[model samples]
Target: MPEQGKKNTLIVIVGPTAIGKTALAVALAQHFSTEIISADSRQFFREMEIGTAKPSAEELAAAPHHFINSHSVHTLFSTGDFENEVLKLTEELFKVHSNLIMVGGSGLYIDAVCNGLDILPDTDLNIREQLNQQLAEEGIGAIQAQLQAADPEYYAKVDQSNPQRLIRGLEFFLSTGNKFSGYMTNSKKERPFHIVKIGLNTDRTILYERINHRVDLMMQAGLLDEVKGLESYRHLNALKTVGYAELFDYLDGNIQLPDAIALIKQNTRRFAKRQLTWFRRDGQIHWYEPDQLTAVITDLESSLL
Candidate 1:
């Protein structure tokens, strides 16, 4: 335990997909004799295990984990909801553990927990529905063009292929007549616990190879059948992710299975690139090769001490 006057520490493990964040987090949690909070937004839904690459049952048993497969895909859990729940969980966990581990590749979710999110005004539902319709009819390019015209700053930084993000940006512009990026205060919120961010990375070629292998493994683990089971809920926002979306296209007869699998690998690589781009902007993160477990532990101990 930390000294009575010392604040609890949140050791955050951030990295791209298939980068071994789960194994690292579990190792760190065991080292600290503490628990873990998963900040990976995709893993929150219970139905998404195979595609989301959720920790194995053995891994979950190795260290107590929170937020992994905790919610149903039918539920609409937003980043704001995550922020509130994680803040409460962290406060409660800190009373027992001096150091806690948080691991995920979701940059926005991690940002919400580290620095409070700016509460934008409620967008008009009509505008959101219209944008969604436009996305379905005219495709992502139409929304991308609109966002580029309205909020070039956010457009440049956002994943242009994601309809939800583009819609949100365009909705904010239409509703408030201001760029979505303008609403982001970017101010770090004071937390009761101290935060130490650790980022894992590797050569791009190696990372892409890992992603490809992971996708192949997911297929072997029945990701296609898992996606087929959720066909009824394909329109849900929760299903609008790289793996699921690509598979859905296959099920829709829009692409061949092989092509869909290839697209999954390509899109996942792109998503990893975007995640790195987002994390790179945060200068506080200490970067290390994914396999440098001992060094990460040593650095973390130095911070705690």
Candidate 2:
């Protein structure tokens, strides 16, 4: 337990996808007798279960969790919205527990809670509507090319597979003649509690293998059926993600099922690399292997005290 009057500690778990983040988070939350707030934007939508690799019923029942299946895919939940909601939720959770766990591979969402998000200028709704129209009419390639030309830096960092992120980058540039990357000063924001960041990673070969195996498991677990059920909603930004996007391609006859599965593994590997790139840039995070839970708890307890 944390000492009296010690600022509440938010132990943030971060790393590449399929890096055992959920398992580590559950263990830590249980040990600390605290609740978990998921920062993985992918896991927020209730419609996305098998593909998101959400914690199992047993794991969830082991610890009280917040933000898993907390939103609908049909609704638009921006990063700014997630930032505000998580901050308020964290404040409330802190009131009950001195230590809490916030876990995810989504660097932006976690950063939003630890360091405030950049102040974005208001954009014209018409501009957003036009961009959405362009996306629907011209396909993701159009938005990808535009964003790459306008802001290559954000283009390389943002998920190329996600149309929503791509459109946001292009929209920001069109709205203001400034690049989206320019607004990211990374200026630290003060929070009421102390943050302890823990990152999990391993050899790239092993990580890729893990990602491939995970994709195979998702297929065996009926990821195709899940994507099929959401077919009517493919146009939604929520469906523009790695697993769903590739499967949607198969369902649309753009590719065979085998090819779609292959693409899922390939795209997932790329996503994990991007996640590592984002987290590596932050120097505050303590590095650990998935097996180093004991050391993390021991060192973390000392730091909290």
Candidate 3:
């Protein structure tokens, strides 16, 4: 039997992108009669739909979801903000329900809510201005090199093309004389309730096929049009993401449309691989194939029972 006074457990559905995480999360939430909290970084922005692979209208209507399309592209939000907001929201939800669902591919954001991360010092506006200037002038490679010099270990593991990661790494190294990765200690916090982490995966080939197909679906769903809409904002950090970034190249005539679409699929495959690599390191999570929905729900119910 479950212990008395123990608040409801938080069920986290996490895996690589386009792995049917949102569908699985909605299914689980509907089963448990609870709400969902999105851990996806890009889905928070209202403008990124096709690229982010956000929940469809039917799925959103199937269950109550929070934190999806809640912010604008111009807003400055971080994983830290997500952590704080999710924690508060979960606490409030606990008042009425014992089980809540969170789903996304952003491993860092998921880790933030599951295990509290260190709150770094605020960014100096001047430092940010200087970094932005250097980023634009020197390009992403220069910032990546700077990060490598400061935190070689992190540089090896992080997505080197990501300007936000590179800029933040350099900022922390310059401001505090420490690697940004050093602050990422996965120390578990004392949560008021328990947590059950469920991971969704499949054979590598199957997962890759799913990813390729998903990219195709996104393209058909107006991903190119969406990218064109945000073309002017390509200079922003959010636009530096995979799908949009590659399409921006197409728009700039750097690559043909077909080639750009190919690159999107290729890069998306790579991103999924990285996400799996990140999630695989955690042995505590219960893994399953997306097809094992009923069995997973049964297993989870058994655990909580």
> Which candidate comes out best when scored by TM-score?
2
Put down candidate 1 lDDT per residue, 1-305, tens digits, no spaces.
55698888999999888999999999999998999999998899998879899999999999999999899988878889999999999888888898999999988889899998997888898999999998779877799898999899888767665678779889999998988998774577888888999999999999999999999999999999999999998877778778898899899999999999999999898888988888998899999998899999998888899
Q: Mind giving the per-residue lDDT tens digits that candidate 3 earns over 95-174?
A: 88879899998888888888888867666667767988998888777887778888986675565556887787788878
Q: Which pairs of residues collide in candidate 1? A: none
Q: Could you tell me how far off, in angstroms, the CA of residue 198 lies in candidate 2 after the best superposition?
A: 0.3
List the candidates ranked by lDDT, beginning with the highest. Answer: 2, 1, 3
Question: Residue-wise lDDT of candidate 2 within 7-29, one digit each (tens)?
Answer: 99899999999999999999999
The list of candidate 1 runs beyond 4 A from truth reads: none
User: Of models 1 and 3, which has the larger TM-score?
Assistant: 1
TM-score of 3: 0.93
Better of 2 and 3 by lDDT: 2
Please give the TM-score that candidate 2 achieves against the real structure. 0.97
Query: Which ten residues in a row are the worst by lDDT in model 1?
Result: 156-165
> Best by lDDT, which number?
2
Better of 1 and 2 by lDDT: 2
Q: Which residue pairs overlap in candidate 3's backbone?
A: none
